[model samples]
Target chain A: MIVAVIALGLLAGASGLLLGFAAIRFKVEGDPMVEQIDAVLPQTQCGQCGYAGCRPYAEAIAAGEADINRCPPGGQNGIAALAELLGRDPKPLDPESGIEKPKMAAVIDEQSCIGCTLCIQACPVDAIVGAAKHMHTVIARECTGCELCLAPCPVDCIHMIPFAPSITTWKWTYPAVEVKAAA
Target chain B: MSALFPFHGGLKTVRHKTESNQTPIQAGILPPRLTVPLRQHIGAIAKPLVQPGDRVLKGQMIGQPDGYISAAIHAPTSGVVSAVDQQPVPHPSGLSDLCVTIESDGEDRWIDREPVDYHRLHPSELRQTIRNAGVVGLGGAGFPSAVKLNLAGRSEPLATLMLNGAECEPWITCDDRLMRERAAEIVAGLQIMAHLLGPAEVLIGIEDDKPEAIAAMTAACAGTSYEVRPVPTRYPSGSVKQLVKLLTGRETPVDGLPVDVGVQCFNVATAYTVYRAIHCGEPVISRVVTVTGQVHRPGNLEVLIGTPFAELIKQCGGYRDGVERLIMGGPMMGFALHSDEAPVTKAANCLLAAGPAELAAELPVLPCIRCGACMDVCPANLLPQQLYWHARAKEFDQARDCHLFSCIECGCCSHVCPSHIPLVQYYRYAKNEIWAQEKEKQRAEQARQRHQARMERLEREKQEREAKLRQKAPVRTEVVPHLDPLISVPSPTKGEGSGQVG
Candidate 1:
């Protein structure tokens, strides 16, 4: 009995030592899971998910404090990707967050812009460029269509326009296949 | 027949060549107005050189090549620029693009022509000249020929320079007629390409269906060290990768080009253009187009670029009775045109006005029974069924893993499928979706980086503002050490009360 106990004890102690060594040798620097989740989330920085930005939402997701469906800008595909990554069942996006919409470009009515710099300060991606008291303009390419600048505009000059697919941006749609009715 | 290496899974489709190749290529009449698209070749669109009101000479550079991979555009005839505006161009999608409309002035005036000696000029300079001449692959790809002539990233010793005279797509006889007529000029162009590449062997692969072309090309290559080998007639044998394999026995890497296998291939028509550019100092203002299908005269015509399709069709006696579709290319890989009003770009090799008899019967698409027929006919040797399934399910990543981009969209699988499934369409859709997703990911990465930079800048600005305020506020803070403790805890209520009292 004592020999068996001693052998078991040595085996357990050896494994423990190996694991302890591995913990230090392969120590991860930071929360890499957060980074992975952040990569899956579209970095719109819209703050529709009740978080400051996509990164914070990703952090909350990593901490299990936020649901994956909260990212409306990310859409159903993003939720599916997150679910696949986290090994969870995919769910529909939360309606309270906002419904998925077509890609939009924020356009500023330049004539109506008061030059107050409110929209510039409110822009998350700094796509709006202008000096203080100068007429501000939105860089259409850089604007994420986040609609973050709309609420901050005192003169209500900011407008979100749906981007129409041009020849370069247009893509071929799925081929129509005839579905047979089940007998 | 030589011992040629065969590629996998090709079709033995019906050849509609005899209908078009019997007659000699005729010169097309100049239309009243020519609308040339800025984006003829694949790359950045050429920048407009003249405004709407400016007069342009025939062969004058109207659109300058914008980037390294772009090709220049020239006026087909001397005329005033009528309008530089958006118009319908010949595309699979009936969308409009920026076009340079020129009103033809009866006199086909020429720009000053300076023919350069290719032997004396450097290869790079020659390539630049070819690019300036707007010469592109006339095998329906429309890629800038000079870009392909460049041997920049190639590391291996050049093995073979294969000229594709295959004209493998059924109903397209432009290359065949060019080979039969202008063999010597095409050979001259091949020599220039060989001088640039320095390949060990120069080969020409023509489909066996065109015997006259083979004899012509062979006779033209008599004194030169160029071989004209006739490959067995097969659909898509004209594709770059397949032709490379068939002629040189080198299978191009799946995600790579023909150059990766130490081979450079060009269409015979492209060679002819190269010869014209260097020997005659002519830019690519015209190309031989096969006006076949339901047209009254199903023959080849050397139509000028920017000529309206309707005019060219009218030159061929217009559309016949029961004209069903106006296709831009061969029936296999071509797309239906909504209107013949679209101008013919450099890529318009064949404007097939397909009748009801020429088109495949509209069969209803059915479910796949896992029949390996599609796999048996795919030229790229990919499993089309699985690709179709993944694409249908929107499982793009899985489709990509199945080597979706390797598919050349040759439509061989679709042609052979018993279920009548549009397999190539699914593949095209999947490829486009993947490209769109990649572009979105790149945009997102850019946004993230900009956001981070903006945050850092704001933080830095706040710190600088605080430092400036501190600097402006006094050295007296350090003078009284006892006051620091009291100042650290601000009594906001007392201060507000004192301000109210004041």
Candidate 2:
């Protein structure tokens, strides 16, 4: 019994060391750029970029599988952010993702909704709310401004208006301030 | 402001700077149509001051702000707003943004515009008028200048209005040229800014690399109280924090603004805009952008916010061949654009048409060797390698502890990375993952709240129905808990196949 136990212990220790050494030997160097490209991405899960989410897009950027301009949600800021991270020249956003447009959110007029929950089920972000046989409402903050909920609604009660910018949701845009004439 | 605070993380990558700074800043001729996006400056999307059918004069206010934080959008050219709908804007997402398309009227008529003579107005009045003119920080930060000028804080104004002429990013020459050519106006703007933010001295910090800019600025500020100081040419010497450190010898505390050290820095361009805003009745409608890189003709062109990249590129004689990427700013910290269709925004200082020949065909990214090169030049003092590890492993908790949020995404790490592991990309992914997860968590919490409410309502209604049923049958007493008959959840199988929870 002592001989058997000693043999088992030796095997286990040897295996552990082997595994540790293998990990260091086979270690792959990772690109640290994925994070910066990711930051410029819109946190929206709206897979408008064809990726499941922003992280996937970041992965593609790091992997060179995706173009930085495909993110419609991140807009120019995202593109600039990615360009900055990659040490590449900042470019215009890709036209394929979609053009930069006024952001909008879904709104449901309860008066015309007729208690249909069609939009509730269709919403990828679950922004549109209401149950069957009950009036529906839109949770604006939760809405990704993707406009997905509009098509699913059986009645034409849903409308996507221009996104209203409040103090909290607003981000600063660089001003076009021209330099002065030299004194 | 560096008091040797030992900011422990960052990388001083090879500053490529081979293209732009080499040439004397040149201006592109023939002004084209300028499509101005309404929400160019941050805050509320300004209401259109001009309609699609209305003929606007150059520098005309096309969009008016509804509130204080908002800025007015101006007509880049005296033309009709061709369209006032969603046009492709220069955003990373490449999504269409609200813009006023102006087909340029070749005349470029100067509408009754007057420049503010700063000496005539009181400092407070000058600030208000400048705010009314909608002048904001020309630096990429894009902070509202009015708020910065009117310091609600009780601290004595001890900082100098450091005019940043050090165009740190290699290919961007908008500020450098502005300093070189328009030194007097820039100085005048600086003087105005100083008067408004008084007790503050005027220190125009130009990089030693641009001796012409330094000489011009020195010449401009000779008779005025403003002083043109030349600093060592560093990659980010123009950064407000770094310049502040060089000038005042004070370190802005982490997570604190330059104002914390009783200092406020303004870009030289911003000062120039202040001068124009106070002097001319012009809102910040147009800006000078460096249009260079792999193009036939490259020069600095004054473009209106919302001018399409295609137009700008066309004006710059277009790309020579193999245009790989279209970036909105300099190579250091700009966006690699997807299309040439996106319009210029207020923030776009440079437009680069770099193809695979210059930008290079993207190679596969390797892994981080942990040489700690990224740590050497990080202005933020963040452990980028630690962040890279946590991000790759999806261990966001550890990344947060490493101060993931403070990373300015300056691309310093990626620039110095030997293995070409997009270090910044990893950190970005981690941050986005965490942010997405947070949003998901919030959504989940919301769903839970809704579910809980529904459950409570169901319970209350069940009790109410039971109470009603009691009035009908007093002797037979079991309250029916099944709500299948009351609330019918519809199923896809049609009305006959109802979702009944028994």
Model no. 1, DockQ: 0.46
DockQ-based CAPRI category assigned to the predicted complex of candidate 2: incorrect
Per-residue accuracy of model 1 over B265-312 as CA lDDT, tens digit each: 999999998998999999999999999999898899999899999998
Per-residue alpha-carbon lDDT of model 2 for B1-502, expressed as tens digits? 2232222333333444445545555544434566677776666778887777889887777787768677667776777668888776776656666778888778878688876677888767877777666677777766667767876555575566677787777677788778878898898777777777774577777767778889989998898877777776666676777777777777877778888887888888888888788766777777788888888877777776666778778877778877778887766677788688777666788888877655634555555667988888677778888887887776888999998987777777777766666767677677767776576556544543443444454565566556556555634433554533464332222232122121
TM for candidate 1 is: 0.95
After best superposition, candidate 1 residue B403: deviation in angstroms? 1.1
Top candidate, metric TM-score: 1
- Provide interface RMSD per model, one decimal: 7.8, 13.5
Q: Lowest-lDDT window of 10 residues in candidate 2 chain B?
A: B493-502
Per-residue lDDT of candidate 2, residues A18-125 (tens digit): 999999998867655765565556655556788866667778888988877887766785676678678888788778778776667778887898876777656655
lDDT of 2 at A131: 68
Q: Which regions of candidate 2 deviate over 4 angstroms?
A: A1-183, B1-32, B66-68, B117-125, B434-502
